[model samples]
Structure formats: C-alpha cells, structure tokens
Target chain A: MIGQGVLNMNTISDKVMFYRGALVPMAATFAYSILVMIYVIIRSSLTIYGSMPKGERSLILWLNGFSVAYSVMIFSLIMAMVSSLVGAVTALILKKVLLHFNPQFQWNKVLIISFTTALALLTIHYLLLRIFLNGYMTFDYPETFLFWWGFPAVIFLGVVVVGSYQFNKALLGQHLKGNSTSN
Target chain B: MKHIKRFVSYTLFFYATTALIYWIFIRPLHLSWGATFKEINKAMPADSLISPNRVVTTRAINIQAPRERAWPWIAQTGQNKGGFNSYHWLENLFGASMVNADSIVRQWQHPVPGDTIYYGKHQGYQTISLVKPNECYSLGGWSFYLHAIDSGNTRLIIRYPSMEVGQSRWTSIYYYGLFEPLHFIMESGMMMGIKHKAERQK
Candidate 1:
C-alpha cells in the first residue's frame, strides 16, 4: 500500500491516475478538432461560394458550410479519437512499466517519457497519414506538413509532460504522506 | 577498446538514422511528391519534347485560385523573371539567386516560345518550347499545366515527363542518391510557393 490503501485495491483516484495519463492530449484533441472543424467549414464553403452567383452567394455559403460540415465532422471526430486513444495507450503502457519498477512515481522520468512518446507518436502519425487522410493534410510535401503541425505537437508535448509530471508528483506526494512506499 | 566501441556505436547510429530518414520521408517524396494518378498519367505538352521513357516524375498541387489567377505566377518563373517561386533561402544557399515574387508583375505575365529558363548555374537551364496562356507553359522537357476545378480553384500540375532514361549505372546512382531528392525539394517548394501567391487575394 503506497497511499490510503493498496494501489492494487483499484480505487477511483488510482484508476484516474492510471488512465487519465491521456487526459491532457485528449483535451488538446477536443480543442484542436473544433478549430479544424471551423477552419474547414469556412475554407471549403468560401471556395464553393466563389462559384455561386452574387445574388445567391450568402445562401450558397451557408448551405455549403452545412454540407462540408456534414462531410468533415466524421473525419475531425475520428482524428481526435485517434490522437486521444494513441496518447492514452502510450501513457498507460509507459506508466505500467514505470510503476513496475517501483510504486512511487518519479517526476523527471515522467517528463522525459511523455515528451519522447509524443515525438515518436507524431512521427508515426505523419507516416500513417500517407496511407490515410493524406488529402486532409493538403500540403504537397511532408516537410511542409510537418513544419506546420510540428509546432503544435511540440506545444502539446509540453502540456503532456506537465500533465504527466503533475500526476506522478501527486502520486509521489501521496506516497510520501503515507510514509511508506513498500508494495 | 572502450573508445573504439564508442566510436563504432556513434558511426552506426548516424548511418542508421540517415537510412531510416531517407527511406521513410525522402525516398517516397522524390519518387512522386504529391502527384495524383490522373495528373501523373495525363499527357502534357512537355511530353512532345521530353517523352516519358524510363523514369517519370509528375507533381501537382490544388491551388485555391482560378486558372487565370495562377497562370501569371507560373508565367513569371525564370531567373530573369519572377524566379522559380521556390525556397529562395535554399536556392540562394546554392548560388541560385532566387527571388520569388509575391505579386504578379504585368511585364512577366507572358512568356514567348523559344525563351531560355534558367535553373541557375547549379541545375542548368531549360528552353521554352510552348506557351498556351492559362493552359500550358512548357520549357522543353518540363512544363506546368493548369486545370480549373471551378471558378475559384485550379489544379496546377508540374510535369517532368522524362526525369531520366537509360543512363550509366554510376549516373543512375548519382541521380537517385543526390539529384532526385534535391529536385523534389526544390520542385515541391515551387509548387507551394505558387499556391501561396495565387491563393493570396483569391
């Protein structure tokens, strides 16, 4: 028992700490998905609106936006789900391996693990993009695509590191408070 | 022995990463950067001059501008003109003197057939063999074609119908190892640059 009870006891906070390793990236995906949704609707609708007669442009834009939204919503949702799921799975695996070494969480290790995992996942994501949703990326070259998306991934990597670090810190705090780390 | 082992490890790591990066990213793009099947196979005006024989490389982009709007950017592509509309920094790093224009200049809006297009001292030059205003601009073995998808959008295709043909084995290695990748990077940059300029105010 590292805390109030056995970490093996499967308590609510323990589960939250275990699974919610994915929470930050999940939140990021939700946020980025909405931005992508709005951007697509605006950009696609505007291009279509240009083909319309002046009198019907406003109506055309509105209708086109709706249709485009109907089409892209599924893609946007799927991307978010994929990102969150990947992040969650990565965190779960890493945390399990780390926790196996000891019941207490180490802050420095958590940060390093989270950041490296984000980079690896993003690289794989870029490659998998060629096989799926390549059109959605729109950039003619992968370098250009990476240049645009890499900054955001780096930003999220920071968030993930901080989030993972905090969660591990809390677990460590609990362990320290309990005055015992023996499993 | 420890020092020798460390040196060997570093060398192996370097080579491993270079090979990994080449296979994963560089090789695929150099093969056919962003070309669609239809775009790659579609016979172009350049085909008459170059002929797609051994190794064909076709790349294209969807420009969110009318064919008319995007044509001027393509028209102005030459060293003495508006430049190749590519990565000026990279090009200049190789003594290309590339200065990609941001706006369509009136004088450069048209190119007469038989004009020479410079790819700088590094990549040699091409001769303009055909010009069809907002339709096709052919420079001997290379060309750019615009297909209007709608009033507001165009499919800009860059076709080098014959990238290479039956050459010596050593030349083939040079083309694959060096020339193809460098060309892909510059060409892709040019496509994006054209798209960026054409899409402006469009």
Candidate 2:
C-alpha cells in the first residue's frame, strides 16, 4: 500500500513539473500571438485606408482597428491548441530518439534544456520587437517602424527552430553511439 | 527524407489554404457586416467624415461670441479645454502634443483675425472667416495632417454657424457616431472654454 502511495505521489510530482515547465511558453506564445494578430489587423486596415479616397480613409481605418481586435481573440484560441499539440509531439519524439540512441541517456535534462532555450528565445524576440516598433502602432499611417520592429522576431524564431532541430538530432545520435558501444 | 518532404509540403499546404480561405471568405464576410468602412460611409450623409473607426462620440457648444473672441482659444486648443493639444493619451499613440496652455491662453487673450500659433514640430495659422462682434465667430487654421505626409499642408477648419444655436442634424449625427467625446470635447467643450474666456473679456 505504501509503495502504491509513493508511486501515485511520483506521478503527481511529474505532472506538476511538466505543467511548470510548460506554463511560461504557453503564456509567451499567447501574448506574442495576440501581438501578431493585432499587427495583421492594423496592417490590413492601413491597406484599406490607403486604397480609399481621402475623405473616406478614417472610416476604413476605424473599421480595420475593430476587425483586428476580433481577429486577435480568435488567434489566441487557435494558438493555445497548436502550442500544446506541437510541444507534446516534440517532447515525445525527443524521448523516443534518446531511447533508441543510448538506453541510459537522461530525458529530463534534455527537456529542461529545450524548454529554457525556447523561453529565452521568445523573450529576446519580444524585446527586439518592442525596440523596433518605437512608440507607434501600424494603425498610425506612414508610421512603418512597427514592421521593422516585428520582422526581426520572425527571423529569430526561424533561426531558433532550425538550430534546435539540428542540435536535438546530434544529441540523439551521440547518445545512441555511446550506449551501443557500452552494451 | 521522404517523410521530411511530406511534412514540409503538408505544413505549407495547410498554411496557404487557411490564408486563402481567410482572404476569400472571412474578409468578405467581415466587410459585408456594415462593420466595414465602405458600408459605414454609405450609411452616413455625404458630407460627414468619421475619424476613428469603431466608436461614436461628439460634442459642440454655442457661444454668443464673435470669431475674434473665439479665434485665440481655437488656435491654442488643448486637452483641458477640449482640443487635441495636451491630449497626453495621444502623444505616444499618434505623436501629437498639446500646446502649452499658459502661453496659448496668454497669447490668445484677444486674437484678431490672422495669427500664427506654434506647437512642437507643427504650426497653426489662424484665420477668421466670419465674425459678428460679440455674437458669433468661425475659427479655422492650417494644421498639417497628423500623418507624416507632405501633401501641401492640411488644415483644421471649425465653423461656428450659430450663436447659442444647436448644430444641424447631419453634423450632430456624424459627430455623435464617429468623433465621440473628442467631438464633444472640441466643439462643445472648447467652444465653452472660448466663450468663458471671451465673455470674461467683454
């Protein structure tokens, strides 16, 4: 009975740790996704305004602003689902690769490393965006600073995603080689 | 390699299809809802213009003061008095700064017809179009567009077509629907501010 109780406690602790590791990325993605949606909305509105006559521009501008807000809400819901699915699939694949490469390679350490790295990259991307946007939004016409501000974030995310994929593959390969020789 | 290629293709297909659907269906659906600018404009009278898109608000005041009396206050428009001047909320968002009230108020004590007022990185050249001494005044000025466009130079023209009379239904409706507390702040609140100042002088 005591052993069963201990096992239950272990499961609970693992869940708690998993949740803790996941929380920051979830929040970051949600916030960044909203920002991206807002940017898209504003950009769309500006386009509408640009196309309209001078007298009618403001009407379209306001319309675009409200539309963007609505889009952001929808995006947040979709982003949450995508993030969880992607995160879980990634973690599972990494675990499998580690097991195949070296039977004794630590899984927990790799997860912690990946989670922390992703979190750091997200933070840096947001900071760089804030710097480039200056003080105005895309809704403010002729204020194209926001585009420059946010473009770097996309580049950074691309780099991180590709680099992590390569690094994970290399780590799994080394682990597999080390374990096969030992056995 | 085949699996990797498949994954890439699938991701690209999903994203492209989703984007295409959004552009074709969702965008048009939103535009059709009268929630769009074109639709809203069709709803409005031909002469009316709504500045901010989503919200509606506006205000106006009638004063028994001539154009000369009102010109000073209009030229030095600020937040406390209901002008975009000193609207700190807008400073960060739109790069607008309200003129110094002290200088504006002092300089505006008795503005005649043609006076130039200065604010940060911008200028206001005031002109009195019509004036009935101590009765009514129309105040207008050359104000550059808030956007950084070099389209000659834009202007803000406020016409006070009444002395203690309400605005036309058309003006009221557009202002109420589009401008909001800002329209109220500028037309009514600022007008009241001008009236108080001008009346005090009288």
Candidate 3:
C-alpha cells in the first residue's frame, strides 16, 4: 500500500532525487522494519525453549505479546520511522559524496547507498541493545547480537537496494528489456 | 476497467472460499495455540460460565515475572481502568476510544467478582466472574490463570469459551467468519500486552 502509484515520467524531475532518493527507499525500509519486528518477536518467542523456567518464558512471551498490542504492525511503524530518520541522514551524506548531481541512476551507486543506509540502521540497533539489554538476560545465545542484528541488516540491504532499483527505473523512464546486458 | 472488475471479483471469491476452508480445517490449531492437551481438557475457573457444546479455545504464554508482580496488571484490566491491552488503534477505529495504560494505577486495583467489566461504549461487556490475587482472574466467558513454574517465572493461560449464534445464517457467518478472527487477534494481543508490562518493568 504505497500511497500513490504510477507517477508520470515527466512529473519527476531529474537531479532532485525526490521519489528515487527518498519515498521508494523509505517504503522498502518500512518493509524491512516489518521484517525486523517479526524477527525480533519470533526470536523472543523462541526463547521459551531455553533453559529458563516456564514462568520466565511466559514473562518474555507476555512482553512480546504486549508489543503486539503496540498493535500488530505499530512496532514496525515505530522502528521504520526511527530507521528512516537515521537512513535519511545517511542518504544525505552519501548523496553529497557519491550521488551528487547525477541524473543518471547508476545501479552501483544505488546499491552502495542502500547498503550504507542498512548498515547505519544495523549499527544503531546494535548499540541500543548492547547498552540497555544486559541485566534482564532475555536472549541466551552468545551470537545473539550478531545473529539478530545481522539478519535485519541483511534484509534491509536486500529490500531497499532491490526495491529502490526497480522503482527508480520506473521514475526515470528506463525499461529493463529481459536481460541485464540489454538494459 | 472490465479487466479490473474481473480481477476484483475473482480475488473476492478466492478469499471467501479460502477463509471458509481455513475456518473449517485449521481452526482447531488456532483455538488451542501453545496449549497442551492436558491444559485444554483441564478445568479452570472461567469454566463456571462455559456452556456445553460451545467452542473452547485455550491459549497460553510464558512470563518472566512471578505471579506477585504480574497480579496487579491482571487485576486492573477493564475499559476505563487498565484497558483491554489490545490494539488501541483497532479499537478506536471502531470508536472504542481505548487508551491503554502502561503502568498499573494503585487506585484501579482490587476488582471483585460480579463486577461489570466495561469494554467501552462500543463493545458488549463481560462481567467479572473470578478474581484471586496472584492466582487467577476470569471475566465473563474468558479466564486468565497464572501458574508459577518457579519462584521467578510464571505461566499465564487464558481460556475463552464461545460459539456461533444459531438463530440465523448471517449471525453464524458473522460469528465464525469475522468475530472469531477478530477475537483471536485482540485476545492474543492482550496476552502479549500483559506479558510486556510484567517483564519489561520488574
């Protein structure tokens, strides 16, 4: 449910990076955020099988469910909004350095920007969890940080890069003719 | 325009058929989610209001906090009190105007049996059937049981016994098709909401 779809190719101005730069990428990031929420919720849920007593597991589940009352996808919305803010700043910096005044949407440049935005999001999540989640002992695995953070980071990179790439093509009136060589 | 119309009709038909099949085939799993056979068959306090031949669904979740810490939250649940611990947005979309509380208000504690549990002006209300501090709580047709697995951990199990109205086809369709899913979503969210408050704080 992207708000508006199929904009006129002429309406989108080149060198501005309006939809190509922000909106589509934000949409993909939003999807990425939903995936992260699902992952976090599921991971928290799976801890029921850990060595912890069933009561503690219930507590974790209760907390996880409460997040659900944050209502099904609202957790994602919160995560998306925060990640988007971080991503917008990262994009601005990346644009100044790599995407400056380029009307031509280089595939490589888009990939690089997506990767960095995902990286920034991943870094923030890692720092926040590291600082706050030490005492409660919710996550038991040693690789909890890398696994949890890494999964979402990988998803963010994949979604934003591919979604932006395709949408940018439409934004700029470029057509992919079956094969990559033709395009 | 014609192509779009055909697509819409096809999608609606497919969804309706699929939903019915799911209700018939996969409904039991959802009804007994995370519950053992023993738990489902076991009698709990909420069974006082349960009618025979009605569909009974039991869902259980684990909590990190002990019953003592979790009891206040379970006690204060009501429309104008702690709220249902469901999606406030969904409730408000139906004009329920629920603002769920994050903290247990000292004033709202101490609910007793026979109290009418308000679910706002927009919803049908359930009366409080049972309330035992740090033990169990049941409101009308649903029951919430708190079992301490250990001193530090608690297992919260909720049983909801409900069924479709037999009066009319429309009522049956509405009950099984729409109401059941919505109840599941809301109730499941409530379970999580309680768990979240208990574990997140202490």
Could you report the Cα RMSD, in angstroms, for every candidate shown?
15.1, 16.5, 13.9
lDDT of 3 by residue, A1-183 (tens): 221223333433443443234443345444554444465456545533342345545643543333432332333444445655655554445444333433455667667766676667667766787688645323333244333455556755675566556545554443232223443
Tens digit of lDDT per residue, candidate 2, span A1-183?
A: 111111111222334333422332344455555566566555555444433346645543443454444444444445556554544444444334433443333445445555555556557646764688545333342233333334434533443344334444545555455556767
DockQ of each: 0.01, 0.04, 0.02
Off by over 4 Å in 1: A1-183, B1-12, B24-26, B121-123
Cα TM-score of candidate 3: 0.52
**What TM-score did chain B of candidate 1 earn?**
0.87
The better candidate by DockQ, 1 or 3, is 3
The TM-scores of all predictions, comma-separated, are 0.49, 0.28, 0.52
Question: At residue B23, what lDDT does model 3 achieve?
Answer: 49
Off by over 4 Å in 3: A1-183, B13-21, B24-26, B164-167
Q: Indicate which candidate wins on TM-score.
A: 3
Query: Per-residue lDDT for B73 in model 2?
Result: 51
Highest DockQ scorer: 2
Stretches of model 2 off by over 4 angstroms after superposition: A1-183, B1-72, B78-86, B99-104, B117-202
lDDT of 1 by residue, A18-134 (tens): 456445454555455445447655654554444333563464344334433333333344454666566667666556645654344555666667677667767876788767855
Candidate number that wins on TM-score, 1 or 3: 3
lDDT of candidate 1 at residue A182, scale 0 to 100? 52
